[model samples]
Target: MKIKLLFFFIVTLISLSANAQTEVADQPAGLEGLISSRTAQRKNPDAKMDGYHILIIFDENRSKAEAIRNKFIAEFSNKYDADVIWDEPNFKVYVGVFKTKLEAQELLNLVKDNYPTAILVKDKLKFPKI
Candidate 1:
């Protein structure tokens, strides 16, 4: 019984030692540069831009869009990112940066009464270049 147990312990130790091997791989030339470039891309803060935003209103008149934005800001206690983007003939007023559609939907329900046409849109938002 002792001989069997001793043999079992030796086998287990040998198996464990054999399994503990360092991982190493050889890559083609230029692969290291590609790998570093990929890391650099991930390190950039602005690489990720998928976020849900609410389009408060769209109008051909810039003044109308600005007025709506101001009114919305004045009435709402929370601060929102307000921007006017020209989409062809019309200027779009977008507000708020929500990480998910569910979050935007919750706010949309509340703001819908004020801006009946307000809808959620996926906008790629980046931190303004400082």
Candidate 2:
């Protein structure tokens, strides 16, 4: 009876250890498969630009332009999430690539209020290679 009890205890410990090992081994494979699937989805180039693009112009002088750029960044950073591009002759600040012209117009209105000098220009605005 003593030998039987010892064997039973050893068998139970071994089964528990095996179960724990299986669980540990399965977790990483599951995570890796998920990661690989997500990577594959991102690798597909079916993504298209279905959004609106706006062009903005700001004065590009040494003192005034710097101040305007700083002010625009501080003010619209959270509001419109603008992407500012500084050209040599002028400081051009472009806002979001909105999904609709109305969205761009809304941002233009806001910009007009903040920077009254700002103008809504054509989307064909170009920036020199930086």
Candidate 3:
């Protein structure tokens, strides 16, 4: 049938192309080179680690979220950084990167006065600052 002939032709072309390949390495440059280099560097050490944090505020409004983040930054006596995360229905204001729930709770206790509903939330934690 004509269908059988077409299938044979396709297989023949694929086999021909497959056999005509070389083992030449790619010369990635610019952005690709930068990405490859960074990934290679990460292989030796952790670029970041998964951890926990304390949620200072969860607000649907962007302005409220910014206000909470700014308030914590101004009043917090610790070295932890506060960041606003946008997740679906709300913006979360998270402060500090703790390796354990206990560590997060310690921070939560300190922030309870300012953020009454503050609680520990597990999330990705960045490497400790040098």
Q: How much is the lDDT of residue 32 in candidate 3?
A: 89
Residue 58 lDDT in candidate 1: 96
Task: Please give the lDDT score at residue 122 for candidate 1.
Answer: 91
Rank candidates, TM-score, best first: 1, 3, 2
Q: Give the alpha carbon lDDT tens digit for every residue of 9-127 in model 3.
A: 99999999999858897765687879888777556456667788888889899999999888788886547888899998999988998777888888888889877999888765667
Clashes of each: 0, 1, 0
My TM-score estimates for the predictions, one after another, are: 0.62, 0.43, 0.60
Ranking by lDDT: 1, 3, 2
How much lDDT does candidate 2 score? 0.62
As for TM-score, the candidate ahead, 1 or 3, is 1
lDDT of every predicted structure (CA atoms): 0.85, 0.62, 0.83
**Residue 21 deviation, candidate 2, in Å?**
45
Q: Taking the tens digit of each residue's C-alpha lDDT, what string does model 2 give over 23-65?
A: 4334655798899876775565553334554555555655665
Model 1 deviation from the true structure expressed as Cα RMSD, one decimal place: 4.9
Model 3: how far is 48 from its true place, Å? 3.8
